[model samples]
Target: MAAQQSQGIQTLLEAEKEAAKIVQQARQYRVQKLKDARSEASKEIEEYKKAKEQEFKAFEASHAGTTSTTQAALDKETDAKLKEIEALFQSKKKDVVNTLLQRATQVQPELNRNLKKLQA
Candidate 1:
């Protein structure tokens, strides 16, 4: 009877050791899985960032041509307005000078009349 009791105690100790080993293995597997998940997530994020950067470069390349075309159109419009202003000034130049001369004569009539008589 004493030998049987000793064998039972030994069996219990063995079972306890087996349970501890299984628990330790489970913890190690969980840690390894977590590390693998983090590494995969980091890789996915880097790939997504690179893809977005490439998309932005493509957009910039496409818009560059439109920007130059728009700038050229604006330059042409500015040149047309400048030419129109020059033409308007040329057409009114003679009238503006005649008005100035009349105002000057009115301001000093005696000196202007004497100068006109001398010229005649």
Candidate 2:
């Protein structure tokens, strides 16, 4: 009777070990599935973003020739260009002022360093 009881206990331990192994495998599978799902979701989100960007680009291209919005955009762009031109003039304003001053004073001001460098 004691030997039979020991055998039963051994069998129970073996069964428990197998159950534990199955549980561990199930946990691993669940983790892998979750990772796969998250990766898929991330890929889908990126695809959605790309699709939205393309749609927006298409809409913008289609509307670029429309009168109302196009004119406003053109006006804004024109203003930007004008501002750039104004900035360029401002940047060269000192040179222009110096040249004008020398002409008015009838004195040859020192030659421009940049011009001398360029000539050399």
Candidate 3:
């Protein structure tokens, strides 16, 4: 009976060791899974960033010609407006200068009414 009791105790100890090993294995598996998840998440984030950058580049490329054309149209419009303004100024310059000269040279002299009243 004593021998049987020692055998049972030894079996229990072996079962406990097995359970401990299983627990350790479970913990290691969980840690490895977490690491894999983190790496996969990083890879997904990098892919998303690359995709966005590609989209941005595509958008810029698509609009590049339109942007230059728009700029050229605006420059042409601005140049036309400047030419119109210069023509208008040239047409009106002689008239404006003549009017100013006439106004400056044609001042009329008048007697003061107050001086006449004082003298009377």
| lDDT for each residue of candidate 1 in 17-107, tens digit (9 for 90 to 100) | 9999999999999999999999999999999999999999999999999999999999999999999999999999999999999998887
In candidate 3, the residue pairs with backbone N, CA or C atoms under 3 Å apart (3 or more residues apart, or in different chains) clash, namely: none
What's the TM-score of each model vs. the native?
0.61, 0.56, 0.68
Q: What is the C-alpha lDDT of each candidate?
A: 0.96, 0.96, 0.99
Candidate 3 on 1-120: residue-level lDDT in tens?
999999999999999999999999999999999999999999999999999999999999999999999999999999999999999999999999999999999989876999889989
lDDT of 2 by residue, 22-120 (tens): 999999999999999999999999999999999999998888779687799999999999999999999999999999998899976787999999999
**Model 2 off-target regions past 4 Å?**
67-120
Ranking by TM-score: 3, 1, 2
Give lDDT for model 2: 0.96
Q: Quick one: best TM-score, which candidate?
A: 3
Q: What are the RMSD figures for all models against the true structure? A: 10.3, 12.0, 4.9
Candidate achieving higher TM-score, 1 or 2? 1
